[model samples]
Target: MIRAILLGLAALACLAGAAGLWLTRAHPVEAARFEGLTGDAEAGQTLFTAAGCASCHHAPDAEGDARLVLAGGQRFPSEFGTFVAPNISPDPDAGIGGWSLTDFASAVIRGVSPEGAHYYPAFPYTAYTRLEDQDVADLWAFLQTLPESDAQSIPHEVAFPFNIRRAVGAWKLLYLRNEWIRPAESTELERGRTLVEALAHCGECHTPRDALGGLRTGAWLAGAPNPSGDGTIPSLRPEDLDWSASDIAYYLESGFTPDFDSAGGHMAAVVANFAQLTAADREAVAAYVKALPPE
Candidate 1:
């Protein structure tokens, strides 16, 4: 009787393990949602610039018009490992040229790849998952218009369990969220919220994370250690910034602070992107930043 009971317990444990794996598998979006959608390249350029796609995807040290080439060799050092951005140009072999709209949508919003594998959170799909389908479609259209590059993608330098792509599924189950961190109360705020929370993914840098790499939502945009080991990413809370809405807007456009200090380090690239936006859009972002509560 004792032997039989032990065997049953072992069988139950095996079943539980299998259930866990199944629960953590990649979850792609329904292809039906994009059925009638068409992309506008003009609008997509706006989204692409706002999203700062070139900052990480451009060839290392690329400047001027060369920045437009998304050859993808930028290295992002993190606690997990150094993640090499992948080639996202229009090359069918080296990039995403062959990807279908469903594949793109799933990769963008669900953090699932075309081959049904989970993408590491280094890609920041957690924030992107909140993006509207139409904006994603536009981005896709804009991507196709760019020059193709034959440059190959470099592999990420991760170790053991962290290197296992399948393991990311489990991580996603814990950290991935579709809900907005700061829901908007008005139409103007809504635009700013979408830009900051979804498209630009400001919180991906500013928000601190848990031991499991899950964002600490309770202290949203309260700042985090720079993943690249430079220094702390500063808090965007109103108390910390202490800038007027106009001041913030001006800084975003010109990269200058009220004290006349200019944006340096990675923020310079961000300022470059924001400068591409319309004056009204910059003000909207400023308003949103000014409205943030201290965490």
Candidate 2:
């Protein structure tokens, strides 16, 4: 009887080991590449401003809005816990000066930093993944132009299993699409679709989250509760809004609603970014949102 019990325990241990191996396996995807270096620092600057990289990461109290200076210690409270945005400046020690272009691209597109660290979705890389490789490269170049700071990044204060960085590998496998936005031949709206998907990343905030905290695809851009504990993010569908697509476009560019209310909550920061965009890009985003079906 004793021998049988020992064998059963050993078999269970082997099964557990196998399960662990299966769970931890690295499923590598093809790395994205950009060719010919048409990346313009100017264009990248526009994209960066539109994306609102500074609103969350940069310390609000910093003297001037210099990207090189590390103004750490901004905390964002979420259901998972408080997440402090790290300094992305070119700081050799604390920031990303140590990163290569590939490393930077991985962080933006794959949500994994050079040191194999996983960034919380609060960093908004889900939307960022829609960016083209040239755009990503340009953003990298623009970042390099910033002065390097010496601010040490703070550790994330998330709870148990959520704190495990390797677990993000599972999250990526389930939700992230590695493909770039493809232009469809169907309509003039196709370019708008590409622009919205790659640049706007509307679904990140507006879509509902699944049990595993991934966005539910079928409900893309449908209004959902704010992750920042503020209030609900209202639907952008044309049916829901009493405004026209041009009105929406104007609002996005200028941060004013039809009622003359200023964009608030998380959207305030979003509008700040949008204010930096060109007239054409803002129109594309508005056109795409107006085309979305109502939730």
Candidate 3:
């Protein structure tokens, strides 16, 4: 009887190990969609701005034209640990110059690396995963156009079990999906939805998370404590927003609300990115925000 019990336990352990391996397997997007698309560098620049790549990739003090230099040393403080952005310059030895277009797309859209490793979500691929294949292609082209910088990537400061990057595969299995989050009723709303849910990744800041740091899908974009763990990020629901579509657009464009209240704190940086976009884009984003359910 004792021998039988031990055998049963051993069999269960083997099953558990197999399950773990399967759950953590690398799953990449299909190449059929990403292949053969010629990217336009001019249009790619706009996408880059909308995606706010410079906000994280550029050196913290980079200003004006210097923002174009993608040396990538910005520090992000989080409960898991601090993440240092990587150098994405065109340097063959030190930057992403070694990366193939497929490699780039896989990393940006699937959160998987060329070596089949999962990337920490700090890179915002969760939101970027919403990007169309063509958009990813264009973003890749624009990144290639950036000047070469020989700066090596600063390593992440994650501690203990959190530092075990392989464990992130299970997290990806739970939270990562390539599909659109909600159905859209119109072209305007759809356009805005893509920006808010995808490139803008608004929920990364506004939405609360579970104990494991995954976004709380039920709450969606409802307010939560900031990732930095200080002040709270405001809810973007229609009721909480308290702004007309026009007001929201105006704020996005000029950082000024109907009452002339200027955007402050982290929103200031967000506003800076939005200001680079055309008037139509801002209006679309505003319209989408106004249409959300009052949560």
For each candidate, what is the lDDT?
A: 0.90, 0.72, 0.87
Q: Tens digit of lDDT per residue, candidate 2, span 57-80?
A: 776555446633544667888788
List clashing residue pairs in candidate 1: none
Model 1, clash count? 0
Each prediction's TM-score versus the true structure? 0.97, 0.85, 0.95
The digit string of per-residue lDDT tens for model 1 on 121-183 reads 999899889999999999999999999999999999998879888789889988889898886
Worst 10-residue lDDT window, candidate 1: 286-295
| Preferred candidate (lDDT higher): 1 or 3 | 1
Report how far off residue 208 is in candidate 1 (Å). 1.0
- Strongest candidate by TM-score: 1
In candidate 2, what residue range of length 10 has the lowest lDDT sum? 26-35
CA deviation > 4 Å runs, candidate 1: none
Candidates 2 and 3 compared by TM-score, better number: 3
Error in Å for residue 252 of model 1: 0.9
The candidates, ranked best first by lDDT, are 1, 3, 2
Cα TM-score of candidate 2:
0.85
